[model samples]
Target: MANVIVAGASRGIGLELARQHVEAGDRVFALVRDPDNAGELPGLASSSGGKLTVHAADVTSDSSVADAAKSVDADGIDYVYIVAGIVGKMEPMLEPGDWDTFDEAIEIMLKGPLRVLRAFLPKLSEGSKVIAFSSQLAASTWPYGGFYPYVAAKNGLNRMFRSVAIDLKDRGIVVGTIHPGYVQTDMGGPDADITPQESASEIRKLAEWWPLDKTGDFYKWNGEPHAW
Candidate 1:
């Protein structure tokens, strides 16, 4: 079984990813911001049939990420999925704009994954897969507004992973981004079309069969290619 690290595994899609991996008998290291206050991650780890370990990590913090990475075994990880992000306020921008809100979104959605990658890249084996969460809003063709920061940040994440895929290609490491669909989570809201379980399951399946040929592309939860 593969050694999988699910960063931002405290709740929502990330939690489901960790659950699925552990249930499938893979060794799963779940990284969350607060180990003490995390909703169910602690309980899940206790009863994960000995396949799960919970690590306290906030992707926004480099030291926390490094500590979490140090907890992983030296055999090298088979998969690393970064799923932390925020949509920020849905309000339209003012004349001068809300730079603070925009910066927060960019930090979490873009820089957070980059920090985790920097800390864990050394633990990734040649055939390893690194997947980061992006959104369809990141598409340049998608004419939208109000969520500018979120969209721009996800787009940046996509480009970063794409470049990483190229840089790590010769070593057999596959780096890619995925749009988990309009999943029904707190972030996705009540009107979202799909459930977190469905999205997580599809993601797991896709990662299992993800070919080296499609290393740098973005994909929908159903395994369909998504245009950048």
Candidate 2:
């Protein structure tokens, strides 16, 4: 069994990823913003026979990420999944007046994962896999002006992870990005094409079949490569 760390495990795809990892006999370290607020994860972890541990962390906070990183005591993490992000109400990007709304979106969607990767890199072993979430918006241009910040942030994440993969390749750490499609999560809404469980399962399959040489490639949940 491998040692895995999943960020944003409180709900949606992250939660399902954690559940599937535990079921696969992997030791899972689930990081969430609030332990007290984690609804079903705590119980799920407990039922997994001590295979899972939840750590409280706000990805936007450096100290919180550092503390959460220290909680994983294994020799090194085998996989690190960055699944935390936010989607604001669909509106024109300029409608928000470019202050708190844009700032929040950038922090949670872009800077947050960068902070987590920086803090946790040292804890990952050689041959480890780092999978981060990107979005379809990163590839396709949207005619709507709204969600500009979200689109830009995910594009930034994809670029950052690509660079990370290049830098870490010789060390045996495979860094890559994935788009989970339009899943029926809180963020994805009810009209989304897929379910969280289906998305998580596809991710697991990708993880298992991931080629070391394809470290920097971006992928879809259905196992197809995505355009940058």
Candidate 3:
């Protein structure tokens, strides 16, 4: 069984990913902002027969990430899933009042994974995978104008990880970004395309078949290649 890290595993896709991985017999280190506040993660851990462990981590904070990193075993984590992210409300670029929302999006969606990488990269070994929970909105294939900050941040994240993949290739680590569909979570809203579980399920299948040759590529949840 693989040792996996699921950042933002308290809820939604992150939570589902942790659950599914645990059910699949993997040892999971699930990171949430507050383990006490995590609705079902503690319960999952308690019943997981030692397969799952919850750790408190705020991806936007360096100190918090560093502290969380200490809890993970250095015995080689097989997968690091960076699933913590946020989306801001649609706002026109001409509007000058959405700075806070935009800032929050950038902090969580862009810098959050970078923080995770800085702390957890050493935990990964050769042939390990680093999967970022990115979005199709970042893709140039389908240009979207609104959501000034969210789109920009996701695009920035995609580019950053694209370069990181190259830097880590010599180590035989495979890195890629994935758009987890328009998941039916708080961020995706009620009328979104698919449930969090559905997206997580497809992602699991993709991860199982993920080729090292496809490192640095972007993909949809269903294993479809997505344009950068």
Best by TM-score: 1
lDDT (Cα, 0-100) at 203 in candidate 1 = 96
Which ten-residue region of model 1 has the weakest summed lDDT? 89-98
What residue pairs clash in candidate 2, if any at all? Answer: none
Runs in model 1 lying further than 4 Å from the true structure = none
| Predictions in order: lDDT | 0.89, 0.88, 0.89
Ranking of candidates on TM-score, top first: 1, 3, 2
Over 4 Å off, model 2: 95-98, 141-145
Distance from true location, Cα of 170 in model 3, Å = 0.2
**Candidate 1 lDDT by residue in tens digits, 111-155:** 999898889988886789999999999987677777878887999
Residue 188, candidate 2: how far off, in angstroms?
Answer: 1.5
Give the winner by lDDT: 2 or 3.
Answer: 3
User: What would the TM-scores of all predictions be?
Assistant: 0.96, 0.95, 0.95
